[model samples]
Target: MKHVTYADKALFLDDDSADWLMEYARALGSATMTDTVTLRGIGMDGNEVEATFLLNHSTELITQTTQSGLQGPKNDEAVGYMQEQTRLILTPPPARSVDDPLEIS
Candidate 1:
């Protein structure tokens, strides 16, 4: 058996940037490594509300193991390790530096 894991991250944004970020997150939702978004509302408590996102990711693995290794599919162990090593943070999710060539604006 193979186990699946999920993870989430949150980012804060101002009024204008929040909208843009939300839209961007939605667009990337269908990708293999995109942020699953849950837009939070602003509060009057002087604390900035955060835009919570579940990075639709896989990491944890479930499998039967013996002395040698996993006793499942041939590539299960490799895939599981790869999944764990894969970064939950998505490409083009946010934070483009000034020197980033991919930045359009």
Candidate 2:
């Protein structure tokens, strides 16, 4: 498990998920955009819950390994979305040519 600290709130998530979040955040920051991602994790109270994070260029996140024996929550859907978003941000779509209606000869 890993402890992810964001601003004043934090969540404990599985290793893969934690890593994904960190990478996704970096991608978003590089693109200078913002996105929201929800993941299943353990809160400060030691209870499993869904946490939503708003990632942006100004966002700051810190993740650390934990020694807790608890199993991290499985959230394949969220992870997949994050992966796709990160990929898109890193490799954006190619620009298309716009047809102009006005022609001055």
Candidate 3:
């Protein structure tokens, strides 16, 4: 059966402070390009202090045709797998102090 898995990494920025969230998004876009990953979306709240960026990709699936081609069970299995993976990855991390400077190695 042919299976497709879509995956995305998202970052949430708290904009209640003086930080340059747009600049951060631009930097992230450049770094993602270097790593060959596409940035899916960038959004900011009405106040411009809260922002979100989505980075996304999908898995390649290969399938062999049987007499029936693809079956319902196969499709359901693939959907379940992708859903579980997405749930695990999309859970937000614990909140941190936005006033702290980001550490770079």
Candidate 4:
């Protein structure tokens, strides 16, 4: 177990804080990356939520997440994930040309 002390609030944190948290987690015997944290709670509307932080190991910012039981944010998240999947796939039809009135497809 490693023991170290560091400040919790810093406008801009440096390597010392990162090493400190990693060392502390290791001291606690954690086996995963230190930047990942899971938050679980019931919001004011009484819905339970589980949000996991997806972070850049170096930046420690939540770049993305897997949240449960939250519809609005999930729907918003889907737009970016599903854009490529929502395309129309059409078999080549007769008389279709690259300069057609509508899109070639």
Q: Which of candidates 1 and 3 reaches a greater TM-score?
A: 1
For model 1, give the 10-residue run with minimal summed lDDT: 60-69
Pairs of residues at least 3 apart in sequence or in different chains that clash in candidate 1: 3-62
Task: Output the number of the lDDT-best candidate.
Answer: 2
Question: Model 4, residue 66: what's the lDDT?
Answer: 30
Candidate 1 root-mean-square deviation in Å: 18.4
Identify the superior model by TM-score, candidate 2 or candidate 3.
2
Order by TM-score, highest first: 2, 1, 3, 4
lDDT of 2 by residue, 1-105 (tens): 999998899889998899999999999998898999989999999888988899999988999998988898988888899999988888877765687455579
**Clashing pairs for predicted structure model 4, backbone only:** none
TM-score of 4: 0.19
Alpha-carbon lDDT, every model: 0.34, 0.90, 0.29, 0.31
TM-score of each: 0.26, 0.86, 0.21, 0.19
Report the number of backbone clashes for model 3: 1
Task: Report the poorest 10 consecutive residues by lDDT, candidate 3.
Answer: 12-21
Q: What tens-digit string does per-residue lDDT give for candidate 1 at 28-66?
A: 444545443333333333343433444333322122212
Model 3 C-alpha lDDT per residue in residues 36-81, reported as the tens digit of each score: 2222122222121222223222222122222323222112333343
